[model samples]
Target: MKRVLALPYLLWMVVFVILPVFLMIYYSFNDMSGNLTLQNYAEFLSSNYIKMTLNSFWYAFLITVITLIVSYPLALVISRLKHKTFWLLIIIIPTWINILLKTYAFIGILGINGILNSVLEKFGLMKIQLLFSDFAFITVAVYIFIPFMVLPIFNSINGINKNLIWASYDLGASKWEALTKVIIPLSLEGVKSGIQITFIPALSLFMLSRLVAGNKVVTLGTAIEQQFLTNENWGMGSTVGVFLILFMVFVMLVTRTKKESI
Candidate 1:
């Protein structure tokens, strides 16, 4: 009966997820001529493409680290609060806004002639170029994705057995020791999950990079868009997509291995 109920979900995965992945794999290995070839992946070996891929990793790493640093402490504080649900709702509210709208809103705030500089000018400060920079792009990405980082860590911390912390105290361990040795280790799963959500999406952020960074930062997502949309190179686009999927899988496996070891 339970398996019967899961048939719809199984069919959905086959039709949507599994089939698309297989198509991507097939296309990645072939060229426009429909001949079996590795030229699509080989093209990424060029210095320009390689550098773009690395830049993608670098920005994604920075975003993930920043999000994790900000989120964990915020999650800790929120988990201790009586109105946790209310605060979580507040954190999630911005996400309800369309991402494109949010990006444009940031433009209105961060553009040279936007609200921020207008206020700065009134205060006798020179207007700085805020838009079309890497900083602006990262700032928007972090803001947009921080909720993903927060929720998982919050759930992990909130679910911890309170008695364990009490037990550590009862055993003469200090608060810092209990946190470092007990809480953090136990919350590894959530941390890993948050990283997966935040980092992976950050790597493939095309629209925000274009709107905010204005080509100052080139990511794999941007590369994929260029190949598929602008250049109409489906094979190259699928190749990048396949690499991204493999890289994500590698990260997940490594995280799981560490979790099991601990």
Candidate 2:
């Protein structure tokens, strides 16, 4: 009966997930003539593509790190608040809006003659260039992805046994010590889940890269999109897509292994 209930989900995965992956694998290894060859892989493995992969990883890493740093503390504070649901809603509200809308909103705020610079000028301060830069890219990524980080950590913290925390304090442990030694260790699963969600999407965020950084930030996602849409090189696009899939699988495997080892 349980398996019967899950059949629809299984079918959905087969159609959406497994089928797309198989198609990507097929296309990645085939040429325009539909001849199977390694030429796509060879070209994609070149230095330029490798650099884009690394840059994507670096930017994603920065975004993940910043999100974690910001989220854990914010979650900690929010978890202690009486109006936790309200606060969480506030954090999540922006996510309900369209991504493109949010991106354009940032554009208005960060543009040269945008709200921020206008306010600075009114204060007799020199206007700062905020758009089309690495700073702008990362700031927007963090803004968009922070909720993914916060929610998981918040759930982990919320699920913790209050008695254990009380016990730690009763044993003469400082708040920081209790947090580091007890609370955080037990919350590793949530942190891992959050990182997976935040990092994976950030890794493939071509739209944000283009809108926020003005194409100055070249990522694997943007590269794939360009190959597929702009250059009409489906083979190369699938090759990059294959690389991204493998990279994500590698990350998940590595993180899971680390968790098992610990």
Candidate number of the best TM-score:
2
In model 1, residue pairs whose N, Cα or C atoms come closer than 3 Å (at least 3 residues apart or on different chains), thus clashing, are none
Which clashing pairs does model 2 show? none
For model 1 the local lDDT of residue 43 reads 90
Mind sharing the TM-score for model 2?
0.95
TM-score of each: 0.94, 0.95
Stretches of candidate 2 above 4 Å error? 1-3, 257-262
Candidate 1 structure, TM-score to reference: 0.94
Q: In each prediction, how many residue pairs overlap at the backbone (N, C-alpha, C within less than 3 A)?
A: 0, 0
lDDT of 2 by residue, 80-191 (tens): 9999999999999988998899999999999999999999999999999999999999999999988889998999998999999999999999999999999999888888
Off by over 4 Å in 1: 1-3, 257-262
